[model samples]
Target chain A: MSMPEGRMDEQTIAMRVAREFQDGMIVNLGGGIPSLACNFVAEGREVFFHTENGALGYGGTASLEEADWDLFNASFQPVTPLPGMSFFSHDEAFAMIRGGHIDISVLGAFEVSEKGDLANWAIGNMKDYNGDVVAWIKTGRFPPAIGGAMDLAAGAKRIIVAMTHTTRDGSPKVVKKCKYEITARKCVSLIVTDMAVIEVTSEGLVLKEVAPGLTPDDIQAVTEPKLIVADDLKEVEL
Target chain B: MNKVVASAREALADIFDGAVILCGGFGCVGGMPSTLLRALSELQVKNLTLVGNAPALGLEAQKTAARTMQVPESYADGSLLLKNGQVRKLIASVPAMAIYRLQEPFPIVKALQEGQDIEIELVPQGTLAERIRAARAGIPAFYTGTGTGTLLEKDKEVRQIDGRPYLLEYALKADFALIWAYQADRYGNLIYKGTSRTFNATMAGAAAVTVAEVGGVVEPGELDPEIIVTPGMYVDRVVVRQGETG
Candidate 1:
């Protein structure tokens, strides 16, 4: 099949990533891409949602007026609660995450190394930028809101990263080594991006599938490290 | 005889300057004893150290006669305490989300930017909860690997257990704990509604004084004896919001 003409949109990326979610899995969705993925969870799958903010069995996003400010997800978005839902304290919730009870954790990232080092929390060099200088002048550094990403990244049984393939300026997000701060080391299992699907393995980033309309060279040109095409590279079904 | 108070102000009457308060809430939503927070804001007591999940807590939204527009009026969370210069320090996880450049500033973010006499210690969300629970459980300290190699573990004790590093975290106690509950009986047993129970259930006896601001209050035998999450001994005071004076 010929590669698609352009990159996949946000929703498409989310949908592709959501397809990986399995039934009966207790999943934690991080902010941004991971948060949007919940909308695309396959029907008939009894996947239970876990929010690090201490809620389980979370439902869809609620409309503003229908929002019970009390009912919210980890992203702070108003959400519905399915029946048989339960709540717990922070300690118990983290115990669940750190104890390796969470089956899958989908997170967004600024950069991912071939070895699977993840960095998404802070964007260093803000103080050097002209617009951000005034605000960060006194502290000389911006505080990265790490939240619960590290715990989820390190503790989830398997980690899948859902993000755009490239930055707005066309720089590749998948690199040989992340230049930014590392959130966790060697935690990623699969990476579903707008351009391609890759698996993080001991052999390096192995390309599993290319988004429609793209070729091996098309993905290679944008990727920083060398790419290893799988024996049977397929098109990522949206 | 019951522990129910007529006003939030009365329940919090003994709070003094420089007190450590554990305010329950997750991003201004659940487990928030907002009525008591508003009263505390009005009291304007200074130098409080707040420990909780999120930063902001909101009060009742003010509506005009036509109810066309509503404006949030008071400090129902740590932001108000920070705004009033009442907070000397804050210990929390997910205190505020200031992820991007163009996002509008949350009060806690603004306060930090202005360089007030405030201190913030950002704990990993799970670790924060565990520390608070540890206090209530009477466990002095515990070890976990959540932040072992990250910035959060800098200058902290790190030990290797089963070849994995775990950071030593101390229990987090407070002078007072202010929490919200959906229902309470005259004996101070609390029953919470949905997400509102988040941290309130665990923080019940983690402090010297535990005050509950409940939506409804009933007689002693009204609540189901089998499912009471927090027994009356944990809660020192119960402020019934519906019958309370502002």
Candidate 2:
């Protein structure tokens, strides 16, 4: 039998994170939810979305033909480049990111620890592979080759991961420590999930806010690891 | 070492009671130099002229010694001092954009609208970079094709270049420049890897004293010259970092 979709789905979580963006943000939206973020950025936020192919100030995807074939998000998905945008070599592109021009990096993740360790790119046995997992996906040529995730994970003012609270098999993606390879050591600042909004802290993973129709218990039960509930935990609006 | 100190308190020592500083960076990238900025609290330096992009850390910084001149951007923590009438003047580019992030952008705008001396000077991004470069290069001023024939012409000195009127912009230099670097040789040569080069390189040559806090400190001759963006001649005294990562 086909499964039914829930009311507050993953897309809702994506929008919630997008709204957090403020004016003058030079944000790098990763391949997944990050790319979707353009639709939700508020009308006046004035965020300049950057892609690997040297396009900046891009937003809101339009007709497929109108999209720049060469200018795409991290995933190489055809996207519309915004105005006041410029183009440059892909390697030079990473220089801008490495130069600390980016404000926030909103990404997708497979696992996260209480301290916000990330493991998005590599989860398989590293002893065996050469660390070209992005190439293994075979979508398109990644000229820059995901060159800056490590830098982004380390240098960006904030690193926010957006993912479903649980895995398809009902397993909690949030754990005491991630099972996959660590992308960054204790780098996560925020995690937006379908059921809740969590902020990583020194003490432990704290449940700052819960999602709609999800009681504290409902989220708590599904979350394998015990979460520290802030004294003022409230329902997450965005 | 000149009995060197690290923490923000110790770093501000040489910052005079009154000085003009042109910071480097876009937002946190090159905006404010760390060691100098950190030391600023200790210097408690008062009444200053400054320029450049701002760090994401709002507009004002801890103003213990004294307050900054003009409230460049509203979010600047330093503006608190300016608003209290502690400062004499405040200036910034895109004062409207600066005040936009605040609780009330227009009160400042209204002050400018209702006549509050309107000390703001709106400058184009590329022109700002060019002027800073010319200032560092020791040129008095240069003309650019950017603001020559339009509304920007009124703000700038319209000069004839090749029989055409071009906007004349003066070179902008600073008494001190605070910067961040990936690593520094004891000789004062700076190597900025990744996004660290933004405005820091331009300000390095433009300032009288450039103080840098690097993530790593190394002996001379270790770093590749090709990677060195700023030579040691431009940097005055070098201050290595005390346990900084990323």
- Winning model by DockQ: 1
Clash tally, candidates in order: 8, 27
* Residue B185 displacement in candidate 2 (angstroms): 42
Candidate 2, residue A51: Cα displacement in angstroms equals 1.9
> Chain B TM-score of model 2, please?
0.72
Our model 1 lands, by Cα RMSD against the true structure, at 4.4
Q: Write the per-residue lDDT of candidate 1 for residues B32-79, one digit (tens) a residue.
A: 676777788888589899988775522321111102222234225666
lDDT of 1 at A97: 95
Off by over 4 Å in 1: A1-5, A64-66, A125-143, B57-75, B99-104, B242-246
Q: CA RMSD for every model?
A: 4.4, 21.4
Q: Tens digit of lDDT per residue, candidate 1, span A139-193? A: 4244555678888877889999999898889999999988766677889999999
Stretches of candidate 2 exceeding 4 Å from the true structure: A1-7, A127-147, B1-246
lDDT tens digits by residue: candidate 2, A1-238: 1112322565677788887799988888875666677778877679888754345676676464564323344443445656776543233444566456778888888788877887664434332335432222221111111223554665567888988877788888888777665556777889888778888888888888887556777877777677888899987775
Interface RMSD of candidate number 1: 5.4
